[model samples]
Target: MPTQDTVQRLYDSMDFQRAVQCYLWAIPIVGMESARQTLIDNAGARSGDLVLVTGYRDVSVMMGSNVTTPYVFAHFDLTDRPLVFEYPKGATAGSLIDWWDRPLTDVGAPAPDKGEGAVFVLVGPGQKVPDDLPAGARVLRSRTQRALLFTRGLDPDPEKVRAVFETAKIYPVGQTPDGGRTRLLRFKAEGRLTSMEHPHGFAYWQRLASALKGESVEDRDRFFAAMLQPLGLEFGKSFEPDARQRKILEKAAVVGEATAKAGAFRKRVPDMRYRDDSHWEYLIPQSYSNEQDVPGGTMFEERTAFFYEITGTSAAVLSKEPGSGSAYLAAYYDKTGAAFDGGKTYRLRVPSGVPAKLFWSVTLYETDTRGLIQNEQQIVDRTSRQDLKKNADGSIDIVMGPKAPEGLEQNWIPTRPGKSWFTYFRLFGPLEPYFERSWSLPDIEPQTS
Candidate 1:
């Protein structure tokens, strides 16, 4: 028989352990919830509305964002019926992802149409796919009704992008607008929107509850939904946290944020490391979605780490078909294993054999925001499309610092002196060399002079 004091101490210990477990588990759920909210808020996205983002000057922090390609965003609600999505013949690439950021299917150039353009009939869960589909139309099935349709206009010309966007259309299958005309809602600038910012305190739980309304959970994710029930976030129920519960959740959100941040900077999986001794790592590898083949079905830690680092999803990152996809590598630290400091200058050397079939680019992003770093020049990156001077050995030495190197303004990427930053090396239409590891990228070396 234990004394009253001993019993009280045991209870306290159990409570502390439970709090820690909840904190860690909440990180990934919060990340996914945040992304869903971001799409809804920034895109003004609603069921059955296709929002076309055509302006080149538009700025965003969403993952895999490229200034070179104009974007189109849409959220589909398939609870009532299936929707017909049609695209022009000139789109560069496109994807349809679920609320949890899993790729449903690829469209546009990566699809069977091969850039000639085609119509996609999106069918939601439990919905029967139409057998009598229109000629040349492809039927794609999604496990969830809430889906994100993202497309990129490949042309660099602003006028050409706008023209292509006009050709895209979304409408109900049998309820096409009068005269068979497709309606488009253009995206208007609504100032700088922070869609990825994590909601703090009780608001975090509230947001999750709101997002879960009428949303279907995958069988693999049912366990997560069960875990949230104890915290008053059960599906189809009111999420009203009491005073004490709110305090616990407040601390949990803070701890969860720190854990996610640490995981993003460090390699959580073996494939994430680019080289044994190098600081660079592959942002999205070919094996990223292969976790299910293993005994665990999926590696939760690796998935959390990825969503915490960036947003957006596409089969292009995982597909093996040539000219059908892209690749991304990120580096948070310098060669010396020190966090990148904006005050110091660094130079990255690209060897003679760059492995991109379409184009390659190195874009700088702020460490805190994970968005393109804002500088006086408004230029956040340099690409193969730019006229860059080559080294004697055919390599390119790109300089990055507060000030441009002498006579190298064209190759310099400016950074703010007081901020920390990182870079993403993007390979549009990655080729054989990138996969074979024959083409290697050097680490960012510090420049004291």
Candidate 2:
């Protein structure tokens, strides 16, 4: 058997090929155990530190404002595994539909009057949302709806919440609560600052490094127990974030290593492509810049989709001309016109080459909520492979407005009055120019004045 130190050296030196082999064969059991150890060594969490855990719907809130939020959380009382129904904060604007109110709603509410900075407790699966509350009291139904609970007093802002999610120590409590025994605890500002430096990443890496040092298993457990405090600080009421779930996430991250061999791997890989770093800008680094990739652009090779950040500095890096061997992926608009007048006829001209092995399409959607273009036709129109009017020179023109041209009825995409709209272009198969940035799509120019 390899000593922990030996294993550490091997893990650090393994090449891409060797890494794949190790991931496939060795990491499942021992690898996981070491990872848990690493998490413990790093996270120096105390027993009483608060934590929060949520499901997909709650996760979506971090993605975008328009997407529907899920309601999945069990408020857990740490002392006793009692569950409590923490209602999604907000007012009953219309019917059963609810809006989330944070530090705002907590004010002047009943007993748990968290001024602004408060940490909400995670209820376990054994608990149920209590119904026998006062008239104004509400309940969070499922994990698929948008819900909000902060540490009872620390008016946790959106930014802090995001950071916690990105790197918080987590433990897996193999079993879900049998009855409704979950609970939530509200934490105040005093709790937030107690251990500000021990974020999730710090704890994870520290623990990982320690495991490689050949520490005893009991020491690893002790470290793990220490890490659990911060992980539990952001608690989930229903179930403890168990070990198996963490393994799933670890394997998922390494899945990217396969992209090291882009060419041969492409053929063998399922849905392979690249992911440009631009997408993570506003979402990650907290800044959004006009991503321009001319000759020197970075590329991320993913299994499903690909991304390229283009910078058109000299001589228009992307081509606007038609029939070019470029993948005209998509054309999006924030609004139909400068200011929607409702009755005026607006037109958008998209200049792109449809370079595809199978087919191509241009789809129009209302930007309001992305549900669809709510109009009399009730149809989300598109120009797909089956139909597209090619120019004599071999290019295509897509029309989006109220009415279609005299001869271009088939290519017309309807629009709603006073509403904003956007468009998307999809290429069926892979193209070389798209990956290399040799060809480019024409800009969507507004025609109507």
Candidate 3:
């Protein structure tokens, strides 16, 4: 026996709730759509084309990448035929992920192929995999035809990277031996941006629709498929949003971007924190799966956070074997628990007992864009591989601010005065000390001269 006004109010409340739910659900979809579009754009929308994306020079803010290792990227369409990926003996680490960002298999060193690489024959849904394969080749079956293959070089030396890059080959099965050679496309250091950002307005929905049409939907993703129905986004259908739908989607995109940003900076997972008082935290879990402490299950928030923070994945980030994979820790605040301000100088000291089997590095990034902070030096990071001056105690000091401290130019990472920034400390081939917490990193302390 409610009045008309009460009934109207109840309906409005339901509508508002639905809008909020839709916004949250769209976050991951937007992420997937952005990544898919990036791959497509880089590959020239052509399937089975490989692009060698990384330079001999150190990665800078130009590409928004901080990776020290040279990288290779490729887009694959396996609907009609299987694709073959051959790796060189010295290939380091990489992964093949589906359009939904679900990793199918690890490639190179961390994989069964090890450093002495092997051929990976990728077969998609309904594609016939040849029974007579090479003796040592591994078969990788993917649920979707649309896949991304990313591989990294072990050494950053220009000559070493070129040597490794020359060995990777991709081609459709049954193609001639000469046709199996991949087209090498080097990344341009100028004006390149690899990080995926949230799409503007209803274009996000358009990209989602295009991705859905290009890729197969998994059973686990059926729920999201159903959710998109209300917004007129369906597989194999045109995503022509109506006026009202466009408005809703536009608002939803804004909210989705905010949610992703919050999740990246203020993650709620307990295992993310490396130390109680420090801003540094483990960016990825030891397990490849997103489950916090468990073996399986999707940690949706954690996955979203990671995609928003960085691109690409590898078994190297998840392997349990010490010195086999790698580990990453990121910090946003100084020792006093204050957000890092580019106007103020800070110093981070790596103690003598740093734990890294291969090497370690600290790279700075703009807080908002997650890109390397632009500086006069054009360099984004300092690594153990570099011949750096060390203190008497065997420790190393890295200074950060607008200007270098006295004669510490070699150890300084410049930060723009008006912006905020963060740093990621990477342990390539991390050892037991890092996992067991026996080795600890000192907090970034503010330096007032």
Candidate 4:
């Protein structure tokens, strides 16, 4: 019964809803929580915003004023909401708990006559721990009530939730030592409160800096100008593809021209971070390169982890060979920088045989949060399993530095001015030592001054 325009709008709305739902489902697999936190950080949210953070067993809420300046928070019960304290005129909420060091007391709902009464305390955040708390030891305000709620499994108790809101206390767990436990309820003030965004909250300062300078709102166009922000997130130096990667993308301009549909494909993908030499793929590490290096493009899988090892003269060898169900490793070095008066050159010696059914590689990350080096032409200055160097004895010697070795120009990694450098190793099919306790990785030898 709707008009054509109205029907069109309804269909559009449905599409949007479906897209949002897809993104929500992809968060866990794609690590979207980290990105969501980053966005919330930029919005400049304040304390006392009813923060609600949860964990495996417990939930916590803190009064924002308790942690305003010098940033502190007041704790509270999970079942009962406490009253806000009257503040002085013209004064903002602040670390009131820190200033007063408020004494511990039963702040939840009151107990019934001839009922059991007890208290619970938590030592760590979100850990429902039952401790033999010292009597009269002065407990923190909300620690007891929050801990009790979980220890007694009262979280899902709708009756307790309803009772606490109305009468300020729920049924206690465990009986008191004497006769009948006098049911006591503690009332805490903090309910569902969120944390404050500050200098280091979530790249807020970065956004603010851009805004104050009248920069564009688009993230990619400001510092590193781009026509559009690359899909996904910028971690280290590379932009990792995100949920959009899973979304069915069409290349043709014609509407509904489904050239390619998303299919259920699964493979083991290694995390492109960290460098530990332990696995078999010593030939090369996973890395991104240019057209000259890898003209066939690159391959990646999902939900996979790789490993490697450093051995022999240096901690750069694999004790065991690799097996199936893994990826390949690659290594490459460029030696053009030695003529620039850069620092000394070093060599990596690997005597242990490379192992793995998939592949492996040893790559370079610029030291200090070693991110893949970003260059002008988009040619990643990294090596991989597809390319590498070999010594006369069939063993491998990797030359590293700002400048290339005399004859090992193809085996060089350029360094930033005077910054320290480290390496990352990737193994496609890391056998067993990754999870169990029996396997140990080789150490990385730093050429100490």
Candidate 5:
């Protein structure tokens, strides 16, 4: 009954709405794609080689990563044959996540192997299981053909970290990676921009379309997948968006990413605030499950918010043991409820008796790339391991500004002017006080002359 003009307007609005929804739904997988591509493009990694990402400069290639340990990772294509991933026993832990960012399994201490070393046969969607599998090796399945293996050694010793890295092995199911059958592809710092956050513009859609080809349509994603077909993302087909679809998607990319930023940084979800008196919140941004799943369904909005800020998750990263896994707290705003301004000065108070069994660190990151903020001074973090100036009560007052504070240069992390920053407080092996909420951290406050 509607006129032609009314019909056209309705279609236009539908196209716009679908575009934004696509961005929200695809945020997690797109993040995984961006990371793999960055490893290939910027970190000099190929499909079958492991890339060791260590040190502050090279770790900057990640999105909201921890610098306390060295991470060695690789992307594998399981479409052809199931791959065998062998990990050595030591102070190492990791995870295997598919292109959708759903963790297939935790790989180290929290795993069935219990860090005593283990082998896994990784099978992908539509891939046939091999009959002659390695004895006692567990089989992990994925919904997509592409997956990444990220393992890190928890020891503080640099030489030990390197030694552990050399023990990993990855080979096709029919072969054994014995006697140097495979080698690790170490990442050397090039001081270039190797951001792993989701890409902007048409690159986002292009990556999403490619990822969908190898994915199995989940029951929940079926309707969303149909919506994408009209927006020029057809599984198994080359991406070719028409002029109209391109225009709609381009605008959606801007609005969708902008919306993601707001939801992630200024979370308003239930139980998002870490403490009643502080602006610092859980880095994962949800209390139900750090992995964002509940009894019946997933926390959709909460998952979207977190994947926009960081990629990959596992039981080890969210371990509930008293002195075992990691705990992360993030502060996106200052005490005045304002986003941090790099041009201004601020100070964070680390109280005495911090609740970390192993070590604790406070690292500042640029919001845009979610990487360590690059400064002329080449400093981005302050840790309990470092010999920083301690207060009379054994506390640490870490300062941040364009210029170092007089007499406090050792504890100051320089920030670049004309930028915004946030900080992550990581507790490696969080202790009882952290779980009991007995040790509450103070918020970062603006310094007044």
Candidate 6:
């Protein structure tokens, strides 16, 4: 017969293990929950409603976002009935992704409609498609109860971007566009509307519990769902953790975060390194599949690393051919392999002939929030589309530090002393050289002089 104390310790250990796994598995949904909760709470927007996050202040609040483009998106619930979404026929690119950060379909450039305007009939998991489908509408089958329609306006002119947004629409299948309760809801200013960082402590589990409410239990998730029961989380039931269970869950949350931070900041994977000579890493490899499905199983580690620091994924972002979608490279450290110190100064040299057919941009994000670095300057990015002075050959150097580097003010982005940061170098419409590795981007160097 086992002693009571020994049995209790064993049970506690098991519970902690399960809770840790829950945290890892729910990374994507937690990110999804943060975005959805923000729109509904801050903007008072509801399902099927399109909320446009425009301007620098608002767009900067989102994870892995840049102010160069206007973000147009909607959170749609298909539990009650099917919804119809219309993508405008203009300059834009992005995708409608499900809860797992899986793309339901590409919308703009790489989509079937190919920037030529398209209609979609979104059907929820196990929901029967109505017979009266629109003639030209494509059916989007979602495995989750809710889906997010995220896209970006790619025009250089602001008015043109607004025009593109005006043409977008979403409505329930049975309702006319006019009768639909959901419509475009644009806030003039982004007043700290949302923070994309996932909740912490017991709140993390709470958010996970809420996310699983309407979500159908997949075969893969059934085991994890069972594991959650002993730890006070279950579908169709309130998650009221007992004192011991709450302790275990709370402790697991801390460990989970540390584990995630370690894996993200310095991922151990071989392919994450963008180039052997550089410290820059690839955000998502060009070969990463939309669903992350591989030979034997899906790439959970890669998916976890991505959603832990960012949001949505799609085929358009994983551009295979040259001059198509986009390519993303990130740097968590400097040339000497040291984490970016906000207190220190650094410079990144953009060599001439960058292989982006459209444009390229460099932006900074706070290490913790993974959102734009908040500072006195308020500006978090510098791009080729802006007034960057390229060399006679199209090369430009960007400076980052606590203060503007004398004459380099126009090309400088302000950094805070105590807060560490990371950056992304994006090549939109990446060309053949980018794929062929003929063009190379160097690592950021700490400025000594």
For model 6, the run of ten residues with the poorest summed lDDT? 181-190
Output the lDDT of residue 231, model 4: 24
Question: Which of candidates 3 and 6 is the stronger one according to lDDT?
Answer: 6
**TM-score of every candidate relative to the true structure:** 0.88, 0.30, 0.88, 0.27, 0.95, 0.96
Off by over 4 Å in 3: 1-36, 39-45, 56-64, 131-135, 188-195, 286-297
- Candidate 2 Cα outliers beyond 4 Å, as residue runs: 1-234, 238-330, 334-353
Off by over 4 Å in 1: 1-43, 54-57, 130-133, 177-183, 290-295, 321-324
lDDT, candidate 2, 1-449, per-residue tens: 99999976654443323323322221112222332222223232122222332222222111111111121111111222322322333210101111111121222122242221122232323345443433343332321122222221112243343343322221212223243323222223222222111113223323223322322222213433333332221212222334533443244334522332222112232322223321101111111111211244311122011111110111111223333222334233223314333234444343455455445555554433322355566445454443667567666666566765567666666676677654445543436654455545555444563
Q: Residue-wise lDDT of candidate 3 within 1-449, one digit each (tens)?
A: 99999987775454434544555555544555565555555445356655555642324422236657776667777877887777667856788876656677777778876778778788888777796665577788877667787677777665676677677777777764486456665544455555455555566666666666756566656676666666667776788867655666677767776776788888776678787766788877433373222445556667677777675666557776788787889887789888899898999998876788888999988877676777777767888988777999999999988887887788888888889988889888888988887778989999988
How much lDDT does each candidate structure score?
0.71, 0.31, 0.70, 0.28, 0.83, 0.84
**Any runs in candidate 6 off by more than 4 Å, and if so which?**
156-159, 188-192, 390-394
Better of 1 and 6 by lDDT: 6
Give the CA lDDT, 0 to 100, for residue 5 in model 2: 93
Give model 5's clash tally: 0
Candidate 1 residue pairs that clash:
none
- Hey, what RMSD does candidate 5 come out at? 1.9
- lDDT tens digits, residue span 1-449, model 5: 99999998898789889889889989988888887887887657766677777777777778888677788788888888899888777777888888877788887777777888888899978778888899888888877889987778777566787677677788888887774555666665455656787889888899888667666787778788888888888777888999989998999999999999988898878776778899988877436464445788777788888888887888777777878888999999999999999999999989999989888999998989887888877788999998899889988999998988988889999998899999999998899888777789999999985
lDDT of 4: 0.28
- Model 2 local distance difference test score: 0.31
Residue-level lDDT for 256 in candidate 3: 70
Q: Give candidate 3's error at residue 446 in angstroms.
A: 2.1
| Candidate 6, residue 313: how far the Cα is off, in Å | 1.4
Ranking by lDDT: 6, 5, 1, 3, 2, 4
